[model samples]
Target: MDNYLEDNMAKILLAGESWISTTTEFKGYDSFTSTKLEIGCTELLESLKKLGHLVTHIRAHDVPEDFPWSKEALDEYDVILLSDIGSNSFNLSNHVFSEGRPTTNRLELLKQWVLSGGSLMMAGGYLSFSGFEGKAHYSGTPIEDVLPVLIKPYDDRVEVPQGALPEIAVDSQITNGLGKFPEILGYQTVTPKKDAQILMTVDSSPLLVNRTVGKGRTIAYMTDIAPHWASQDFMAWENYGEFFSRCIKWLNKDLD
Candidate 1:
């Protein structure tokens, strides 16, 4: 790891699905056909700034027919975020795959990029991991093979009965400082792989999770990284920043 990452600033890819959050608008699909930079990027960047990082954001909002896969476009950052961006933005875009699968070069670059020791954070949303109606399925994608846990083939909604208290699934340095059942406002749930050291859980399923792939690392957030939870936490609790900061530090900690 670089010392500058600990100093005043570090490069970060504050990426998210650059599109509208469609639920019932796209004929039953949370249509990712028109992704946009997630509005939460501002808030997340603000949070990252508190830790001292020069953040850059990438919007895969519009996928032109001649889109190019450039590690130069993504790999230089200290961390890459796959927040709410489903299969369309990275895999199904133009020149990426003719049939919703990543081509060899793109896949190779991504593999090498991570294997060469890049940091990646995978967060969930309606369009993220096995998202709504399986429209953004990952079980069959090349990304699945690189990741430790295989997402389900369908939506794994983190549904809790109204007034239900959010629960912690496992112990980790990530959720170490927070109080018990600290009242997370909202989140998604996934049947994370047993190999994944479950960090938090809702009902026996994983919430915040971590796993390693080659020389790089991966983390999964079963929730939106924005206002719904962020705002709610600010309005209702005190340790939200601590929770979030732990996640970021986990992703970009110095390995030397």
Candidate 2:
């Protein structure tokens, strides 16, 4: 176990990407309903795990209650990944919303954590980066203040059923050896923050943006790491895992 905690390994906290859904089905004059549980970041998680990074996944509903609210607790992770989760998860905790107790704001803690030398990454989804109908709602959160890109106030997802290929926008050591990527189905549209580096683009929108925040770093990938937006073809691409590994290394400043 000691070997697993080596300096080369990055500890990552991956929040969100898990959800529960209920569906109603009709057969002639009768109706039936079923509930299902799903996770969207399996591929991305597995990829990171395979690269020897330690990952702790906190589902969407579990975030408000489970996310660390203290800097001491937050120190356990070198990187925090907010994927497909909305702002409410950080703003409203069960202690405040259900138990009638005041609690520290997790989002504020996260912002401070990043500023004081922790890496942060936001991967896109329906509930990420000003998601569907603007329901993801991170525009006004403290998180938005540290992000490398500005989230549009309205719904930012651009559906591309026909697929859109990512174009390399900058030549940097972080993106070295990365070749042609597979076309993705869709992506969230975001403007790169001033002084932020636009690493990649899809159509006219920023696809991957990065910037340094104090001693730490922040990266925003404006597309899903899983399906619906990231197609099966994209996930199955030869460089899929390698690409993500590179991003993680870049965030940790381990890549040259």
Candidate 3:
């Protein structure tokens, strides 16, 4: 664990998505409070810091069309997280696809990074997985090649009013030792890939999944973090931090 952490420290990049032009748009309601320090990834960073990780945070705004898809940036982090951000962002104008041709394509770079063993995790939201009517369709990107779930031709999001109680995986490393955790508010229903291990399942679908992409591992949490969108349960739930932290640990355990 220590070797993985130390060796992978500089390789972890935490990319957050900010579509709202103003913080004023955010009203801490349901389970989110106006004063809560970490909504989205604000708290997630703190939690990662608590675990001794000094994360490099990049917002979707910071990336530009001419932005260099530097291998320095790619190799710097062991894991790159996409939370509610779309696939098109990385393919922005400045990025190069192959042979260093200038274009909006850092994905080929990201693909090489992962194939060479870099972890990636996607927490659910509008910019994730065929998000909101195929808005953030990750299916066509190199990311889709690594992700455990197949992106439906259209949106894969399912509205669950009654909510679902997923059956836990007995041998899940993520859920291991998490004794009696509070239930998640709700999960966005999705189809699972055969290559992926359905850690937790609902009905016949995969809710929590883990898969190995190249030499790196990827985990998918099909749920939201901010409340009212069914993430209220986890945010309000005491074990929210624990569960998320465990996920981070699994993704960047080598970074420690």
Best by lDDT: 2
**Per-model TM against the reference:** 0.74, 0.94, 0.77
| Candidate 3 global lDDT | 0.64
Off by over 4 Å in 1: 1-10, 17-38, 60-68, 96-108, 161-164, 180-186, 227-231, 234-237
RMSD of each: 6.5, 2.6, 6.9
Summarize candidate 3's per-residue lDDT along 77-121 as a digit string, tens digits. 667777777776766543343445655357777766777777788
Q: Note the Cα lDDT for every prediction shown.
A: 0.61, 0.86, 0.64
lDDT of 1: 0.61
Candidate 3 ranges beyond 4 A from true positions: 1-11, 22-39, 65-68, 94-104, 181-186, 253-256
Candidate 2, residues 1-256, lDDT tens digits: the string is: 0112223678888899889999999999999999997988888777777778888888888888788879998899888888999998888887888988888988888889899998899999999989999999988788988899888889998999999999899886666677888899999988888979998999978999999988889999999999998988898988888888788888888874
- Candidates 2 and 3 compared: the better one by lDDT is 2
For model 1, how does the per-residue alpha-carbon lDDT over 118-207 read when each residue is reduced to its tens digit?
Answer: 766777677777877776676677666566567888776664434235466665677665785444455665666666667666555567
For model 2, the stretches where C-alpha displacement exceeds 4 angstroms are: 1-7
